[model samples]
Target: MLKFIALRLLQGMLVLLGIYAVTFVLVAATPGSPFSSERAIAPEILAQIEAFYGYDKPLGERFITSLGNVLQGEFGPSAVYANRTVTQIIAESFPVSIKLGSISLLLALVLGVPAGILAAVKRNTWLDYLPMSVSMAGICLPTFVMGPLLALVFGLILKMLPVAGWYGPEYVVLPATTLGLYYAAYFARLTRGGMLEMLNQDWVRTARAKGVPEHTIIWKHCLKGGLIPAITFLGPALAGIISGSFVVETIFQIPGLGQWFVRAALNRDDFLVLGLTVLFAAMIVIMNLLVDIVQVALNPRLKYD
Candidate 1:
C-alpha cells in the first residue's frame, strides 16, 4: 500500500510539472504584454516597470526562475494587482469556492443517488420514468443556460433567492443548486446504469434465492459495487467545482478563484494565471489519486501495483 501511494504521488508530481510547463509556455507565447494598455506610458517608465518585474530577463531565465520559486512555495507578486502576491489572492478566494463546491457536491449526491437507485429498482414503472426524465432534462441543459433560467425563476420571479453576489448563506443556494443539478444528471445516469448491471449479476440472484430481504440485497450487496462509476466521476468533478466554476461564478458575480483566473487571462497577468493553472492541476491530480485509493479500498478484488 505504501509503495502504491508513493508511485501515485510520483506520477501526480510529473503530471503537475507537465501542466506547469505547458501553461507557462502558452502564457509566455501569448501576444499582449502585462503592462500594455489603451493609454501609453513613457518608454523609460515602461522599461523601469519591466526591469522591476524581471520582464527584462531572458525568457529561459524567467521560466527557470519561476519554476524554482514554485518549488519553494513562492508564486511571486501579481503584476496587475498593486501590492498583492499570487499566493495571497488564492488564499483569500479559495475558501468561498470550497464552500460552494462542497455544498453543490453534497446536493448532487443527496438528490442523485436516491433517484438513480429508485430508477434501477423500478425499471419499467412510473417510479423509474419520472426521475430518469428529469435526469435527461438536466443532462441536456448546460450550466450557462440553466443558471439564468434558475435565476429568473427563483431569484427574479419568485424572489426566493438572490440572483447575484456572495453575501451570506442564501447567496450560495442558487449557484450551488445550478452547479449541483447539472452534475447530478450525469451521476443519476451513471448510478442507474451501474446498479442495473449489479442487480443482474449472479450474486444478486443467489441472494434472492437464499431469501435475503430485497432491500438488504439491493442496499448491501448491489450498492457497494454499483457506486463505482459515480465514485470515478466524483474525483475530477469535485476538483473542478472546488477550483471554481467559471461560468457560474461569472453569472452569479461570485468573487472566487474562477473570476480571478478569467481576469488574469484577459489582463495578461502571467504570474496569477500560472499560479491558478498550477493550483488547479494539482487539485485534479490529488483528487484522482484519492479516488483511486478509495476505489481500491471498496473493491478488494482490485489490486494496486
Candidate 2:
C-alpha cells in the first residue's frame, strides 16, 4: 500500500510537471507579451515593468525561474486583473470554487444514490420512471439555462432566494444546485446500471437463496461493489466543475474564479489565464489521486501489495 501510494504520488508529480511545461510553453508562444494588450506606456516605464517582473530576463532565465517557483508552489502574479500574486488569487477565490464543487458533489450523491437505488429496485414501474425522466431533464438542460430559470422562480417570482451576489447561503443555492443537477443525472444512471448488473449476478441469487435480509443484502452487499465504477468518475467530474463553469457563474453573477477567468481571457490577461489553468490542472491531478486512494480504500480485497 505504501509503495502504491508513493508511486501514485510520483506519477502525479510527473503529470503536474508536464502540465506546467505545456501551459508555460503554450502561453509564452502565443503571439505576444503578457503586457501586449495594455495601453501604450513609455519605453522606460515598459522596461521598468518588464524588469521588475523579470520579464526583462532572457526566455530561458524566465522559464527556469517560473519552473523553480512552481517547484516551490509559487504560481506567479497576474499582470492585469487583481494585480495579486497567484497564491493570493487562489487564496481569495479558491474557497468559492471549493464550496460550490463540494456542495454540488454532495447534492449529487445525496439525491443520486437513493434515486438510483429506487429505480433499480422498482425496475420498470412508475416509481422508477419518474426519477429517470427527471434525470433526462437534467441531462438535457445545462447549468447556465437552469441557473437563470432557478433564479427566476426561486429568486424573482418567489423573492425568497437572491437572484445574484454571493452574500450568503441564499446566493449559493441556485448556482450549486444547477451545477449539481447535471452531474446527478450522470451518477444516477451509473448507479442504476451498476446496481442492476450486481442484482443479476449469481451472488445476488445466492444471497436471496440464503434468505439474507433483503435490505441488508441490497445495501450492504450490493451497494459497495456496485459503486466502484461510479467512484471512478468522481475525480475528473469534480475537477471539471471546479475548473470554472464560466457560463453558470456568469449568468448567476457570482464572483468566482470562473468569472475572473472569463474576463481575464477576454482582456488577454495572459498571466491571469495561465495562473488559472495551472490552478485547475493541479486540482485535476489532486482530485484524481484522491479518487484512486479512495477507490482502493473502499475495496480492501483489491490488492496493491
lDDT of 2 by residue, 1-305 (tens): 78987887788878877877787777678777666644788889878878877888887888889889777878777777546886787788788888887898888888887888889888899978999999989989977678889988998899988887888987888888888888888888888888888888899889889889878888978888778767888888898677646677788787778887887777666667767887787788878878888877878787664
Per-model lDDT: 0.91, 0.80
Runs in model 1 lying further than 4 Å from the true structure: none
Clashes of each: 0, 0
* Residue pairs that clash (backbone atoms under 3 angstroms), model 2: none
Candidate 2 regions exceeding 4 Å error are: none
Alpha-carbon shift of residue 22 in model 2 (angstroms): 0.4
Candidate 1 structure quality by residue, lDDT tens digits, 1-305: 89999999999899989999999899889997999999999999999999998899998899999999999999989999969999999999989888888899999999998889989999989988999999999989988999999999999999999999999999999999999998888788889998999999998999999999999998899998899999999998898777658889999999988899999999899999999999998988888988898899888899898
Error of 1 at 42 (Å): 1.6
